[model samples]
Target: MRYEKGRKDASRSRIMEVATQRFRGDGIAASGLASIMSDAGLTNGAFYPHFPSKAALVRECVAAALEGQSGQIAQALASGGLATAVDAYLSAQHRDNPGTGCASAALLPEIAREQPETRQLYTERLMTLVRQVSAALPPHTSDPEAVAFGIFATLIGALQLARAVEGADLSDRILAAGADAARSMAQPRGGAGQEPAETGVTIAAKTERER
Candidate 1:
């Protein structure tokens, strides 16, 4: 019984691993169970025993993706501080690779239109990310949560815009602009040689208004 259970668990994990990549690489709505199962090297029949419904599978995939992203952010914070996290997140490499990048940037817009349960799960994970970034913020900040929120919003919006824009030059500009803004946020007020903070530009917002 134990061995059977272990194997079942392994199969379920493998399915999730494949599903995460597919869902991120392809939009969640476009990634079907049959495709995911085949990608996992399992029969379609194997899916139901692990996940009762497509929504269930989606929820799990979202959870797994967010957890993975959270770990990456946490590691960045621990190893190189907020500036490093900002540099890593707002780079061309991250912008060009949605599947291996941040889940919020890859899925938040679509997830916002999903069922309440899906949104709730996303909200929880987003807050977890907020807290992780918040803790790394300078101790004297007036409100760490708000600062974290602003930075989080900036990171996701920048990455999305970078990927959405038509020209490589514009996209790279968007990312570089975001990295500069984030670096400003991480610096202390009145710190030596630090220039005054400027209002950040968000190409996503401007592009949406134009559309």
Candidate 2:
């Protein structure tokens, strides 16, 4: 029985890893169960043994994707101030590596029409991200959550805009403007609308090529 349970756990993890990559690369709707199963080298029939339905898989993937991002976010927060963090986060690297990156940047629009369970799962993930960001901020503010919420909104919005444009120049501008915007948002109330903190973070300045 213990061996069976261990096998089930390993299978579930494999399913999650493959599904996450597929969902992020090609939006959730485009990535079907058969494809995910096939990619994981599991049969379609095996999907139901772990997840009851596609929505269940979506929920779990959403959770795992968000959890996966927590480490990057934490590193961003801990290593530098909010501006530097935004610099790293809004880079082309983060943009190009969608599969192993931010779920919000990759899949929110794809899951817009999902079921209630999926939506709830997304909401929880968003809340977790907000808390992580808020915890990284200066403690003088009365509403760290509010600040974090604003940052979250700005980053996702910027990514949406950047992803929409086709040109490399425009994409770079979008990321620069986004990092600037997020940096400004993270600033003190009296110092609003200023430029980014200019810690000279390399990731933010990396040229945007095909990836």
Assess the local accuracy of residue 43 in candidate 2 as a C-alpha lDDT between 0 and 100.
88
State TM-scores per candidate: 0.86, 0.84
lDDT of 1 by residue, 1-211 (tens): 2349889999999999898888787888899999999989999989888998988888888988888889998899889999899989998888888877777788776788888898899889889999998899877776888889999888889888899999999998999988878776765665468654443454466677799
The total of clashing pairs for model 2 equals: 0
Best by lDDT: 1
Instruction: Compose the digit string of candidate 2's lDDT tens values, residues 1-211.
Output: 2348888889899999999888888888889898899999888988888999888888898888888677777887777767678988899987777787787888877678889888888888888889988877765655989988888888888887887889989998988888877776666553356433432243456443324
Backbone clashes in model 2, listed as residue pairs: none
Candidate 2 — which residues are off by over 4 angstroms? 1-3, 191-211
Query: Which lDDT value does model 1 have at 37?
Result: 94
Candidate 1's C-alpha runs over 4 A off are 1-3, 190-211
Highest TM-score model number: 1
